[model samples]
Target: MMVPDRVEIDAAGDAVLAADQAAALLGVALPAFLADLRAGVVFSIVERGEGADAGTLRLTLRRRGTERRLVVDAATGRVIAAEGG
Candidate 1:
């Protein structure tokens, strides 16, 4: 099993690289993602468990009272899983 590279988190607890990739995947700009983070949106980078998503960066985004989780490949920045809104 190959380990993914460590993702750096900013002081605001936002995973910088994962957020950038997620914003691009969502067709949004980096600024928009930052703005959302500033506006009390919840963002977190978690570790995926077993199966195909194992060892990936699981980015959970919660904004406007809606919650969504995006499973991203830390190495490739590919969105492997997206759930909720």
Candidate 2:
């Protein structure tokens, strides 16, 4: 029951894209995306708010050593995006 027991991996919204689509949106290799996912550097979250007032989580990845940079929002634990260099 770690990932909502299957439900956790599901997205309730319509705008949400599938894994392949997400990778295309991010313009990254599939292996790289998987790496980010395994590193807990990829995620999504919806903030409680009206319309357009909700804050979004953004992840900026950078190559430091054996891992990447996972930038996230302070309020929500969602990752917006990631990069590898």
Candidate 3:
């Protein structure tokens, strides 16, 4: 298994955080999420918001048979909601 140091995403404008920044921010905010990643038991899915969800990001990490989802504020780098992990 291979893990990336940073996941860079090119999003138009400055309202959203880059992919790598979001991943790092989430790692710091959720210890268990990071642990799953370190253990190579997680797969990450990143989504950029549109319409009313603009300026936000949805980060999903799947571990084992469970899935953890989080909605993050792109500008502030704060997690708006976290489900599961």
Candidate 4:
């Protein structure tokens, strides 16, 4: 007897948001961010929450000397919280 060559794992239906998409929801100028990034004056970080904060994405963008942070729901792509944006 031979086991199946492959097995499929099932995950509950959920909507996952991409980092770029999450950033777009903040209504910031992407072009400027790109420019600053190229000039090494801007940086970004994307993090996913766990446990009680599961299914959430935390995005932080820094440009010049300012920082913007946002918490988005992974399943619905909604901005849960925003600071300094």
Candidate 5:
């Protein structure tokens, strides 16, 4: 018997998160993050698809303008934040 350590889904049902997801996470009151992406302000970890379609990254925008990803056991992604002084 073999156990799979990581599982990746490439179906249409679960498409990779895009910049739009960033906007929603940021909770743009009147759409502010839109310009950020175009200006390369927002950071991301792009995971290219098999072929033809690619360059999608799973990210959650932050007020700091630079959010660092962490690994945790919880379902809802949570990262330890630092107090910006």
Candidate 6:
């Protein structure tokens, strides 16, 4: 799959906020977050549940062959969930 450029993702407004929140939760800087996003990270916007207008941003990152996922609430910029470290 083709990963989006930072500018393209940032253009959506909420994407950048979600990325920033996820990065902060992981204790990383914005540049590092963007770099990771560029380096085969998987990102998507998903609805919280049925009837939920706002969605969460899901990010999957791999490091040293270990993959982890972070779910960030787009409306509040909060990390709602994390998996696999």
- Displacement of residue 50 (Cα, Å) in model 4 is 1.0
Please list the residue runs of candidate 3 whose C-alpha ends up more than 4 Å from where it truly belongs after superposition. 1-40
CA lDDT of each prediction against the hidden true structure = 0.56, 0.40, 0.58, 0.56, 0.37, 0.52
Off by over 4 Å in 1: 1-36, 48-53
Q: Across residues 17-40, which tens digit of lDDT does each residue of candidate 3 receive?
A: 343443444444356656666888
The worst-scoring run of ten residues by lDDT in candidate 2 lies at 1-10
TM-score of 5: 0.36
Off by over 4 Å in 6: 1-11, 14-54
> TM-score per candidate, in order?
0.46, 0.38, 0.53, 0.59, 0.36, 0.42
Regions of candidate 4 where Cα sits further than 4 Å from its true position: 1-32
Question: Candidate 2, TM-score vs. the true structure?
Answer: 0.38
lDDT by residue (tens digit), candidate 6, 1-85: 1222221134453444356655554556778867877885634443343245346666565433445555665555555666664
The candidate 1 region of ten consecutive residues with least summed lDDT is: 1-10
> What value of lDDT does candidate 1 attain over all alpha carbons?
0.56
Error of 5 at 70 (Å): 7.8
User: If both were scored by lDDT, which would come out higher, candidate 3 or candidate 5?
Assistant: 3
Candidate 2 lDDT by residue in tens digits, 1-85: 0111011122433123345544544556668877887887776543333345354333333221332333333344444444443
Better structure of 4 and 6 per TM-score = 4
lDDT of 4: 0.56
Query: How much is 39 displaced in model 4, in angstroms?
Result: 0.8
Task: For residue 56, give model 5's deviation from the true position in Å.
Answer: 16
Point to the candidate with the largest lDDT.
3
